[model samples]
Target: MSSAKVWTIAETSGRRLKPVSYELPARGRMLADKLGTRLASVVIGDQVDRNDLQELFWRGVDEIYLVTHPELAGFLVENYSNVLIALIKTYRPEIIIAAATTTGRTLMPHVAVRLPAGLTADCTELDIEEETGNLLQTRPAIGGNILATIKTPHHRPQMATVRPKSTKPLPRDESRSGLIHIVKFNPNWIDGRVKKVGMRQIEETGAGIQDTDVVIAGGKGLKKGENFSLLRELAMLLGGVVGASREAVDRGWISYPHQVGLSGKTVTPKLYLAAGISGAIQHLAGMKTAEVIVAVNSDPEAPIFKVADFGIVGDLFTVLPAFISRLKGGKAK
Candidate 1:
């Protein structure tokens, strides 16, 4: 067997690769370099384009394990886990990481329980411990009030599912190269018990909060559900999406999909505007990576100001209307 390696699972939506697939290798590459091991990425799907798989090399993977079969078109836990277990047993990786998406969250746990290894979920950060060389996995704990770091000392393959958007993908390097090994599909891996019935796509209006470049987020300070209209108007003016803090979601001011925090979606927008959000650590964990942050809060001492590129210490109702008016080429009343 080859020396213990660091591995990242590439996530796909049909034939297209997801963004987190590249992001994982960027971080995994760093960990692999620090641990003196090679970084390998696994892609399992039917008819995934070779050009798309090549992006893994540009993102700093030393090898690409491509497993394809007609039955692998859609994700089924039973079949996917069977294939993954076989690879793990053969390669014997020292570390395994996947995105904390619906597929990853479900697959990793299934693989871990079968391998009987310790697994961490939704890690925001990962590092290598110098003294022991254990993979340090950091995640929010205790209702998102604190961060906890965990290690799998007894396990051969340390496993974790990292939250999407927690880290940015590395700049692509076309000169980088790696080996592509095609793993033969085993029909026996398919489970007779379960079958993929059909897939449904949910239609949504406008861009999703996670995909938008600019995000205007609200919090408890917005006062009521109707006040979210203020944020929607501003978002429309800015050509962005509206996001909300968990507090606002819990109060039924907004739907859960619009919520941004540790328990919610992690977003890396080009510009993030926080209107009336106090900036709890959990909320900060979600959008701290925004290229430019503008915060509006009445309190000068609000934590949001600390991370904001531009801070306005004033009421959101007053500040937001002024912003909307200016964007519309009209003077603030």
Candidate 2:
């Protein structure tokens, strides 16, 4: 082996690269530079666009490991893990990072066990320790009330899954250059135990909260599940999606997909409207990165006001209808 390098697993949907694929290299490049190592990205799919793969180099990766085969079209944990394990054994990277999406949450643990390496999941932050060169993984712990930093000092490959949208991708630099190495697929690596039959696509009302430019989120102060309808209406008027704090989701006011917090999806919308939320640290962790934060709470001392670009001190029931009325071209009392 020449030297230990940093690796980022590229995530793809169909033949297109996911946004997090670029985000990984942006972050990985920083860590690699800190460790005085090279940054590489592993891309696996069938007939994936070469142009999409090349963008990784523009983002920051110094090397690309491309694995393409008909059998690899659909992601099977067994097949993907086998391929990754084989590559790891050969390259022996010092660090590996993947997005904490569905594929990553499922695949990383399986690969970690097979490689017998320590793994961290849903990390909010990653850093390189100066003296030890350990990958520092930070995540919310104890019900998202506190943050914990972990390190795999004894492991060969420091593995971590980072939450999507936790950080921004680096600006593309067309001047950057890298080499792509084609990795051969092994037929025997495919296991008969698991097979992909089909994939189902669920119909959603509008764009996902994560993808929307505006987000209207409610919390425990909304009082009941029915009250979430007000949020839905406001979201509709704003051409956005409705999101819920953990408390509202816990109360069954909305589905988990609409949740925004440390335990849920991280959103970086252009405008985030929080209603009846006290702004716990966990909830803030997810939406604080929004360009503009507007909070509405009855309590003048609510923590949400601390981060809000605009704050309103009033009962949500009274305040919401006024907003709805104004947006509808009706005069507000």
Candidate 3:
């Protein structure tokens, strides 16, 4: 007898697959295996990028379910939800994971209501229980003071919208391979309650933070908004994005989109370099998954060091400039 299926819904930005989309297979493989099932992915768009899918094969996905339609070319919440709901009904996957992005935050809820299934949001980690095979969903809660583990004890096709940068995408191995199953999509399948009449661009938080390999974040220790220029310059030198602790954002030192904490964007970067941050729990909840964390704070006892891979007890104003200078020197070479 086949066990339940595991599926991940992939996301795209500017027609390119988002980094978190690529990172999901690593987790999918684990969950699927724990359930003794196969792992698959779903790509839904108006015009799916066929070429970029080779990386998914290397990531150990057993199959890629490609659903393309002219209507899906642009994101209409109703249309996307309709299509996903169709796939869920057809394939009957036991678990579905989506990125906790604007689209996902909106889309998943719609589908969940229709499926009448339980859905969890902003999960930082996922595991399967050895005893009951239930999905173990973990995240920071209560102002990030507690790490909560939740499960949908009675729901079928358990759904979760995970915070971006929470898990590493499986590494690519050309030796691995998979099948791409094209789902025939029909435009008339949707009710058309929502329409993408015109497009406007509004700023959102943490671009490079959500997808980049490196992130340079600042805190109140930066002193003022103007001081963020140092962090920006360093980000430029390092080819990374600039992030802010909630303190910096509240102080008007940076915008809310740049905040990294329980209330801000969660990040999974290869390197997260934080300066002047005291390492509050809310902040750690957002970025404790960074492959490497380097914290620089004047106070050696700052809580950030508890989770940091490297620490420097020093004044950030002095430390950041020196770091930027060193990066610039290396770049010049």
Candidate 4:
């Protein structure tokens, strides 16, 4: 029934497999099953840990292509893309999916250009067309206003990059069976144009924003940058992290990393508490997937309330402190 295989790129960071990497296998497995083909994953890095390999199998990867080279130890766009381009040429897979994280967003496009394949970015959903067996890539298009489904009918390897939190990983099964094949390639394929001469890793407290259980985000309603401390206090009390809207960052109230919106990061926390942010469509696009949304605004007609599960039409200055007091053993559930 199937002619070829469904492939996904498994990415690692900080020397461990990123959570988003597992998400690819979860999504790729479903499509592979529909096409009656096996799901294979390719990981490119200098080091491949044994534990990480087993973790991929647990997530339902049937085979692993270990693409490694001394030059790939550091992420150079040219080197990484060349390795994948070679792999794609050799395997000629039917479909290729990757995580929509920074690495994947940068890497896939380079490979696509070399292979001259049709590629889509930031896809929220993926499916297989029963009649044509085409890879149906669905994503938010045109300023996140409409959902668009794109198909690469003419491309040999249908390619797509999936948003990190859009899908969940399959449960890990230690008993799952699979194989790891080390891939060898010519080191001369690399062209040293861009180089990573220096790097700094800032430690962000709490779990990652996308994966956090609770997120406390502020916006223009805060009135001033200094007020972010109020948010930080509440975040610490709640065992959560602080998030911000584009306006807050634009006003120099917070750093860019904490921003949440279409122009920023997409987050899917279990509980999202928004303060002073008048739910712009762009802001909503980033956090709409959160399981539970709580909004606090001075205006009852604020757009954030339209999507929030619970809303308080009042001043965030008062509401935030009150919540902090109540949670700090005062008397508020």
Best model number under TM-score: 4
Better of 3 and 4 by TM-score: 4
What TM-score against the true fold does each predicted structure earn?
0.82, 0.82, 0.86, 0.91
Candidate 1: which pairs clash? Answer: none
lDDT of 2 by residue, 203-259 (tens): 444226765678999999999999988988899899888988999989888888888
> What digit string (tens of lDDT, one per residue) describes model 4 on residues 1-333?
223389989887746777887888999999999999888898888776778888888998988888776677767778888888888788779899998777888989999988899999988889999999999998887666789999999987999998776677898888897877778867776888888889765455523676567789999999998898898988888778899999999998888888898888888777899999999999999888788999999999999999999999998988888888888975657
1-333, model 3: which lDDT tens digit per residue?
Answer: 223399988887546666777878888899998888888888887565666677877887888888876667766788888888888888888899988888788989999999898888878789998999889998767755678888998887899888676677787888987888888877666667767678645363355567677899999788889988898898888888999899999998888778898888888778999999999888998888788999999999999999999999999988888887877788563
Pairs with backbone N, CA or C atoms under 3 Å apart (clashes), candidate 3: 23-169, 46-72, 46-73, 205-257
Worst 10 residues of 3 by lDDT: 199-208
Give Cα-based local distance difference scores for all models: 0.87, 0.86, 0.83, 0.85
Scored by Cα lDDT, where does model 4 land? 0.85
Clashing pairs in 4: none
Instruction: Give the lDDT of residue 265 in candidate 2.
Output: 78
- Candidate 1 is scored at a TM of 0.82
Off by over 4 Å in 2: 1-4, 205-214, 220-240, 246-253, 261-272, 278-293, 299-310, 317-333
Which candidate do you rate higher for lDDT, 2 or 3? 2
Full ranking by TM-score: 4, 3, 2, 1
Worst 10 residues of 2 by lDDT: 199-208
State the displacement of the C-alpha of residue 326, model 1, in Å, after optimal TM-score superposition.
3.8
RMSD for each of the candidates? 3.8, 3.9, 3.1, 2.6
Off by over 4 Å in 1: 1-4, 192-214, 220-230, 233-240, 246-253, 261-272, 277-294, 298-311, 325-333
